[model samples]
Each structure stands twice: as C-alpha cells, then as structure tokens.
Target: MKLSHIKLYPLAIPLIEPIKMSGETITHANTLLVYLKTNTGKEAWGETSAAPLMTGETLGGLLQNAKYLGEHLRGLDITELNSISMVLGKILYGNTSVKSCFEMAIIDLFAQAQDTSVWQILRDLSKNKTQTKPIPLPLLRMLGGSLDKEVADAALYRAQGYRHWKIKVGSLPLAEDLERVSILCDLLAGDIVSADANGAFNLDQAVIFCTAEKTRQLSFVEQAIAAKSTIDDFSLLKSKSHLPIALDESIHDVNEIKYFDQANALDGASLKLIKTGGLVSGLAAALELQRRNLKINLACKVAETSLSAAATASLGFAIDSIPWGFSMSNQYLEFDICAKPLHAENGHLNIEQLNPIGIGVTPEINLVTQAHSKEYSTVLC
Candidate 1:
C-alpha cells in the first residue's frame, strides 16, 4: 500500500493514579498518537509516550519528527518497511521514539493490507530457532506508592491471579525500600517477584541493594544503577548481585545488548518500541538477545494506551521467551482511545481475541483527539 498522508495527535493522558519513581512522579502520560492513511484508503494507528529520561525524546520532538518523516515518507511503499526504516535512520540521527511511532503505524497498515493480524505477521517472521512451546505468561505488575498502597494492591492483584510482581524502588531509604520489598515478598510468597530501581542508585548502592538479604527472593533486579553506567559498572553490579539483574535504560542499540551479553553483565534486557524505534528493530533486538540466550522483557512506557499495549503484547507470540514478562502500561490509564481496548484478565492479555486484524485496535478519532482533559493540550492534527 502506498503511504498517502500522516497526522500526529498529542494528548496528556492522565493515569488512574500517580506512580512515583526515583526522581520524578508520573501523573499523566504525555502520549503522541500517529494516524496513517494509505492511498488505498486504509487507516492504522501507532502510539508513543514521551520518555525523555529513558528514550531521550520529548513529546514535542516526537511531534516534529512525525511531521518531517510523514512529509519525507509520503508516496513510498509502506510495505517496504526495511526501506522506510533505512530512510528514517539515514535522514535522522536520533528521535527513535517518533520513528517508532511511524514504523509501528506502517506495520499496522501493512498487516491490514495483507488482511491479517499483526501477531500472525510478527509470529511468522520469527525464526524457527526462536520459537517456543506454549507457556504461561508471568504478566508483570508494579507495586508503587506508599507501603499501605503497595500492600493493599499486592493483596488485591494476588486475588486477581497476578503471580509476577516488580517492587518499584530507590526513592526511599534503602532500609525502608527493603522493608517494603520484604513485606511484599512475604505477602506474595510463592509468586515470581522482582525489584526495579529505574537507574536511580549508584554503583555502591546497587551492590548493597542487590546483595541484601531481603532482595534474595527476587527473580531479578532491573536498572538498579544510573543510565550513564559503563560495561564495567554493570559487570561489577552483576558480580555483587545475588539474583539475576536486567538492564532497561542502558539499552538503546545492539551494541549495548552485545556488550552486556558478551561481558555477562545482565541476565535480561528490557525491549520497548520507543527504544528499538519500531517492531522491525524490536524483533531484530529480540532475535539478538535470544541468540545470546538472554531474557527478553518487552514493555511499554508507563501509562500508554491500549494500542501500544496490544502492539507490545502481540510481540510475545514471536519471541523466543519472555521470562521477565510483559509490562503493557495501558493498564495504568484511566481512559483508552481504542473503541475495543485490550485489558488483562486474571493476569493474562488474550491478544488473539483482540486483534482479529491489524494491531488489534480501531481508535475513535474523537477520543483520540480528546485524550487530554485540557482541550489546549490536545493537538487537532
């Protein structure tokens, strides 16, 4: 299908509740939604949340890049995704977030043209070596906010069949955070558990935190240290670690993936569409990680919509393994733009049920445009 036009919608999507991280508190997700129209009169949607600290692209940058790429990429065969990604990389230096938005939209468009669901296409693209037998999804749920909230949410989610968990850490004193983790680990015993500091700790702090007795039961620790960490730092962190450690913010390209794999620094790497730029590159990164026998953790930026959540979840069908599980951030949203939104039931997202065709979403234009509560923050185009 020929790419005819592109449009961008910026919305400040509020979360159901504010989730506090290390330094920042995310109350609303500044999301940029992309809409693509093919010359064949087909439409598809893509999503990206502004993660300046993680992806280094702000919401405004994503908007401008979308317009620029839309103008340059018009009239081209969008099914030629490789060529499109090449042009995107060639003409631009960074801004992977916006590029990912377009690439994701293009894949949705391509799948629609092929008269198939995105999951089928992505699953078919997986190599035979990367295929895996059916396994239960250890869908990851984060424990944020006060200890009361954390404890209450854990009990609530446990009753709902959430067996996998991540304790959001590093904002409080180490001992207090450890107490929270200890309480949750005990409360949610016999469940798969982990802790994520979101790169808020120092090397020394990371060493102490991972080696702590309370964190012993954790399945893994993610981004324990700062983002500017070196390979040696990660290696050292892993050396002191009693449990497996995964890298999130430190990963951007294949080199970082290879460096950590080669150095035996991390057991898993978190793969996000914004970080990989699109599903094409995301699959490439997944294959690379699988080749090295590293754990794959496909995630979305916090508080994204169902479109991104569905797109990210569809990847589970293609990957070799998701030992760390899926973090589809749409669950954190108060409202979703998609007419039929995908929500997790008993901890698993039945993606096949959602996406009978194309990226599993048919977003309403009105809802898409008015995603923000404040009309001024909503972009018309």
Candidate 2:
C-alpha cells in the first residue's frame, strides 16, 4: 500500500495528577497523534509524547517535525517498510519521538494489512528467540505526592499484586528523601523499590546516597547523576555504590548500550519508544541488551495515552524474557482517548489481550472530533 495522507493531531490531555520529577512537573500530556491513510482507504494510528526533560523534544518541535515528516513520507510505499525508516532517519536528526510516532502508524497499518498484530509481525521479523505465548509482566507503580500519600498509594497497589515501585527522588532534601525511602522499603519489605533521581544528583551525592545503608533495600538506582555527566563519572559511581545502576536519561541511541556495557557503568537500561525512535529500533535495542545479559526496564513516557501504551504492550510481549517494567500509562491518565482501553489487571499487563490485529485498539471517535474542533488537527499530503 502507498501512503495517501498523514494527519497530525496535537493534544494536551490532562494527567490524573501532576508528576513531579527532579527538574520538571507534568500536569498535562503534550503529545502528537498521527493518523496514516493508505490509498486503499486503510487507516492506522500512532502517538508521540513530548518530554523536554527526557527526550529533549518540546511540543512545538514535535508538531513541526511531525508535519515535516508527513510531507516527506507522502507517496512512500508501505510495503517497503525498511525504506520508509531509512528515509525518515535521513530527513532530520534528534526528533526521536516524532520518528517513532510515524513508524508506529506504519507498522500498525502493515499489521492490519497482514491481518496480524504488531507483536506477531515484529517477532516474525526478529532473529532473536522469543516466547510463543504472551508472558505476564510485572508492573512498576510510581510513588506520588507526600510520604503519607505515597504510603496510602503503595498500600492500595500492594494489595493489587504490584511488586515493583519507583519513587522520584533528587527533588527533595537528602534527609527527607532518605526517610521516605526507608519508610517505603519497610512497608514493601519483600517487594522491589527503586529510586529514580532523574539525573538530579551529582557523582558525589549519588555515591553517598547510593552507598547509604538505608538505600540498601533498593532493587536498583536509576539515573542518579545528571544526563550530561561523563561515562567515567557513572563508572566511578558504579564502582563505589552497591546498588545496581539502570540508565534512563543517559541512554538514547542504541550505541550507548555498547559504551555502557564496556565501561561496566550500568547493570540495566530503560527502553522507551520515545527515546529509541520506534518499536523496531526499541526492540532491536532490547535484544542487544538481552544478548549482553543486561536487565531491561521496559517503560513508557510519563504522561502517555493508551495508543502508545498499547504499542508498548505488544513490543514487551515479543521479547524473549519479559522485563521487570510497566507499560501502565493508561492507568495514570485521567481517561484514555481510545475506543478500547488498554488497562492493566491486578498490577500485571496480560500480553494476550494485546494480540488483536494492528496495535490492538482504535481511537475514540469523540476524541478525534474534539481535536478537530479545537483546531489541533492538521492534514499534510
């Protein structure tokens, strides 16, 4: 099938609550939703979330790049999917989220044409060994609000079978943060508690905090230092601290995996479609990390909607080993704009539910109508 048109929808969907990180606070999900149309009247949807702190992509930049990509993608034959990706890679640089958004739509449409799911198509194309059946993945709940609020939230999620919890540190005072983590570690005695600094701590502070006895209960520590810190700094922290390190903000290109692996700087990596560009690229990165025996934290953008969450679920299932991560963005959203909601049950995402053709869900008609009425929708051909 040949591409006929590409429509971009810019949206500011509200989150259930503001997500405060080290340097930023997110109250709404500023994202771009792309609708790809084929000459045969088939349609596929994709989504890209903009996070300036994480991916260095602002809302305005994503919209511009989405329009530019749509202009360049017209008349490209969807059958030659590799060629489409190559063309996108050459058009511009660093708009990973925008590139991923289009790639998702293309893959979604291709799966629909083949009467299969994105998971099946990716697995069939993959050279790595993957499971034949969907494996249930452990979900990581983000600790929100005050310590009392977090305790209450953790208790509720714990009752629901969630074993992994991630707390946002680096924004609070060291004493308060340590106290909060200690309380959580005690409350979740047998479960995993990870502290993500969002690249807020310096090497010394990270080393100090990570080496503390109170923080010893953590399953791992993520992005403790700044994203701009040198590899040597991470290596030093890795050597000095007992906690296993997982790189999130520091990982963008797949090449970084080799660098970190060589330096022994990290024991795990967080793979997100917005950071890796698309499903195909993200899966490739995950396979490489698995080959090196590095743990994979398969996650989503903080304020993602159901479209990307559905996409993440499909990709996670095709992996040879299910990573200890969460694709539960829909649960954090006030409401998903999809006709079929992709919700997790009992703190686990059952991959079997995402086996439907394409990305497993379609946009809600009313959501589309609202975007158009608000003049946030654009058609480029």
Candidate 3:
C-alpha cells in the first residue's frame, strides 16, 4: 500500500515518578507521536522520546525532523521497510530518535499490510540460525525513585514474581549510591539485578562503587563512566571492578562494540530502538552482540507510552535470548496514548496474546492530540 498521509504530535505525558539517573531527571515522556495512513486506509502509530543527554534529541528537534521525513516519505510504499529507514538515515544526519519513530510507523503499517507481526520482519532480517524457544520475557523494573518508594515497590513486585531489577545510580554521591545499591541488593537478593550509572561515574568513583562489598552482589553494572571517557579508562574501570560491566552509551555501532570487547572494557550492552536507528538496525545490532557472546538488554528510553513499548516488545521476539531482560516503559506513564495500551502482567510480557496482528496495538488519536507538549503542524504529508 502506498503511504497516503503522515502526522506528527509532540507529546509530554507525565511520569508517575521522575526517572532519576546520573545527571538526568525525566519527569515526563516528551516525545513525537507519528500517525500514519496508507492509501488502503490502514492507520498505524509510532513514537520516540526526547533524550537530550543520552541521544542528543529534544522534543522540538524530534517534531521538526519527523515532520520533514513524513513529508518526504508521503508517496513511498510502507512495504519497503528497509529502504524507508535507509532513506531517512541518508536524508537526515543524526536524529536517530526521529528516524526510529518513522521506522516504527512504516514497519507497523507494513506488518499490518502483510497480516503478520512486526517481529516476523526483524526475525527475517536476523542472520542467527540458532533455534529460539518461545518463552515470556521478564520485565526489568526501575528502582530509580526515592529509597523508600523503591524498597516498597521492590517488595510488591517481588511478591508478584518479579525477579529482574535495575537501580538508577550516578545521580547521588558515590558512597551514598553505593550504600543505596547495597541496601537494594540485599533486599533483592537472588534476583537478577544490575545498576545503571548512565555514564555518571568518574573512573575512580566507578571503581570504588563496584569494589564495594555490598555492590559486588550486583549481577552487573552498566555505563559507569562517561561516553567521552577513553576506552582505556573503561578497561581500567572494568579491571578494577569486581562485577561484570556493560556499556549502553559507549557502544552505539557494531564497531564500537567490537572495540570495547577487544579492549576488554564491557561484558554486555543495552539496546534501544532509538539508539540503533530502527527496529531492523536494532535487530542487527542485537544479532552481532549475541554472536560475540555479549549480554543483550532490550530497552526503551526513560519514559514512553505503550505505543513505543509495544514496538520494543514486538522486537524482543526476534532475539534468541534476552538474559539482560526487556525494559518496556509504559507502566511509568500517568497517561497512555490509547485506552488499550500494551503492558506486561506478572513481570512478564506475552507479545502474541497482546496483539495478534501487525504490531498488535493501536492508539487513540483523540487522546494523543490533547497530550501535545509543543504546538506543531499536524499537516497531512
């Protein structure tokens, strides 16, 4: 089906609690929501969040870039999944978040046109020949809020069979963060738990935190030092720390992953659709990580509605293993793009049952229209 229309909505859905991490506090999911219509009258939705520190994309930038791509891609066929992303990449330099949202829209529409699921597209793109057993992926919740609230949430989620956990460190002082991690690790004993510094640590502080006796119980530590920090710095930190180290911001492309691996600086990485340019690219990166025996954590940005969460969950099915866990972020939102938003229950996400067609979810445009964070043209592309 030919692409007939495109619309961009800049949204700022409030978060239940601020997602506090190293050097950042995101209280709302400032994002661009793309509403697409095909010549056949098929409609689909896609979204991307504003992560200035992580991805260097703001809401204003997301709105403008998405609008431009939508206009340029007006007459293209949504069936050309790979070409659409390539075109966006070539036309625009580095608004990966915007490109990701556009890719999500096209892929969602493409899968719907084929009467199949989005994962089928990514699975075909994957080069891995390993057989995959269909199992429900565990949800990794954030423990980044206040200490009392985090502890309370941990107990509640643990009772509900939640096992995977990630603590938001790098915001508070090093010793305090270490003590806090120690407390949570003790509370979450026997759980697959990790701490994300969000590139907040200096090499010395990171080594100190990782070497602390309490933090040693952690399953792994992620992006401890800054992205600007040298690979040798990461190697030093990795060697000094007692637990395994993973890189999120530091490893954007496959070459970086290989470089870090050769430098012996990381054990795993966090993969996001926005970071990798699109779902197809994200799957390719995941396959590379898997081939090299690196841990793969499929995640969304800080705060996003289920539209992006559904996209993330859909992509999770193509990967052979997700030992690091899936980070679907819709649960953090105070509002959703639609009444029937996708979500995980009992700490696990079952993708097929959630949406049997395409990406299996749709958004309520009426609600999304009112959730605008900034005024932008909803002009038909």
The whole-model lDDT of each prediction reads: 0.81, 0.83, 0.82
The digit string of per-residue lDDT tens for model 3 on 268-377 reads 99988888887887877787788899898989998888888888877787774789898888888888887787666788887655576677678887778767775554
Model 3 lDDT, full chain set: 0.82
lDDT of candidate 1 over 1-381, digit per residue (tens): 777767778888888999888867899888888788889799888888889788877777777777777777778774564676887887677788888887788888778878887766777777544444324345789889889999999999888878878888999998998888888898988787888899999999899889988878788899999878887998989988998989999887688899787888989889998998888778888888888888888898987888888778777766636878888787888888977677777887664446677887778887776685453343323
Best by TM-score: 2
- lDDT by residue (1-381, candidate 2, tens digit) is 888978887877778899889899988778788988999999989999888988888777888889988888888775665665687888767688999999999998889888998888777767645546767777789997989999999999899988988999999988788889988999998887899999999888899889988888999999999879988998999999889899999887679999998998998888899999999888888888888988888888887778898888777777746555864666787667876677757778787666488988788858755533243556564
Off by over 4 Å in 3: 127-133, 374-379
Which pairs of residues have clashing backbones in candidate 3? none
Worst 10 residues of 2 by lDDT: 370-379
Candidate 2 regions off by >4 Å? Answer: 128-131, 370-381
State the displacement of the C-alpha of residue 354, model 1, in Å, after optimal TM-score superposition: 2.1
User: What is candidate 3's CA lDDT for residue 63?
Assistant: 80
